[model samples]
Target: MMFGVNSKILDEIVCILSKDTNVESAYIFGSRARGDFKEYSDIDIAVFIEDPNKRNMIAVDINEINCIYKFDIVIIKESTSRELLDNIKKDGVKIYQRPF
Candidate 1:
């Protein structure tokens, strides 16, 4: 149960996403969240955004980050609806959460 990337990556992601108005909560999930990730396994990230229209910007940000870093992407919108957020939190590991 060891994580691949160091804590620096988490800090970097938090810092990067925090600066953007589109990003709400950025959660790290999959093997990394469970602490069973290997060097080959890409880090799974679940990003919750405030505006649904900003998804394109979120994707661009993630893609830009991935281009510089190595990881997989999964973006979810929190402000869009409660249903999806509940489902994601219930299903995916709650790596990060922003209080409304």
Candidate 2:
């Protein structure tokens, strides 16, 4: 378990996210990814999906795992601005990816 987060928790989160066919990938960012979280720090997650319209659906599925921990979810599209995507890619820790 990296950054004090339980592997099982990450596994469960990945499992839940994987259920959504629209989701292409998911990453953990912010404090959690940086390994410097405080007591009340929230998990920052970035999800990449093929269909922007399905973002809300993916968020709902992510929220279902919120009981395990507080988290903020950001949905990203292929057309998302390069700057933001680059920042996330540089700092975020990838946690899930759809199987081929």
Candidate 3:
């Protein structure tokens, strides 16, 4: 898949993911999130959910206003551990945390 993203697109993705009932939080990771993207880098997203087993999630590509970006959703059990949160903190730059 062609990999690239911008703040406007990211905002749209966050909005979409937030609408999902299973999702509690959404985040962006990896190169695109770090502002050091190349021509080929899949946009990585971390999705926090009420239950991973509740449903299967997939990446959604939303195009509007001619903006392009890859949006991915990951589902984790709602009760996430501190370690995971810490890891997100350690790699915080890659995370585009949703604004509640």
TM-score versus the correct structure, for each prediction: 0.65, 0.81, 0.57
Give me the candidate number with maximum TM-score. Answer: 2
| Candidate number that wins on TM-score, 2 or 3 | 2
**Off by more than 4 A, model 1:** 62-69, 77-100
Alpha-carbon deviation at 56 in model 3, angstroms: 3.6
Off by over 4 Å in 2: 66-68, 78-83
TM-score of 3: 0.57
- In model 2, pairs of residues that clash are none
Compute the lDDT of residue 43 as modeled in candidate 2.
Answer: 78
Residue 86 CA displacement from its true place in model 3, Å: 6.5
User: For residues 1-100, could you state the per-residue lDDT of candidate 2 as single tens digits?
Assistant: 6746777778778888888888889999888888889766787889888788743666666677635577788888666788878778888999999999
So what's the TM-score on candidate 1? 0.65
Superposition TM-score, candidate 2 onto the true structure: 0.81
Say which candidate scores most in lDDT.
2
**Residue 44's lDDT in candidate 3:** 61
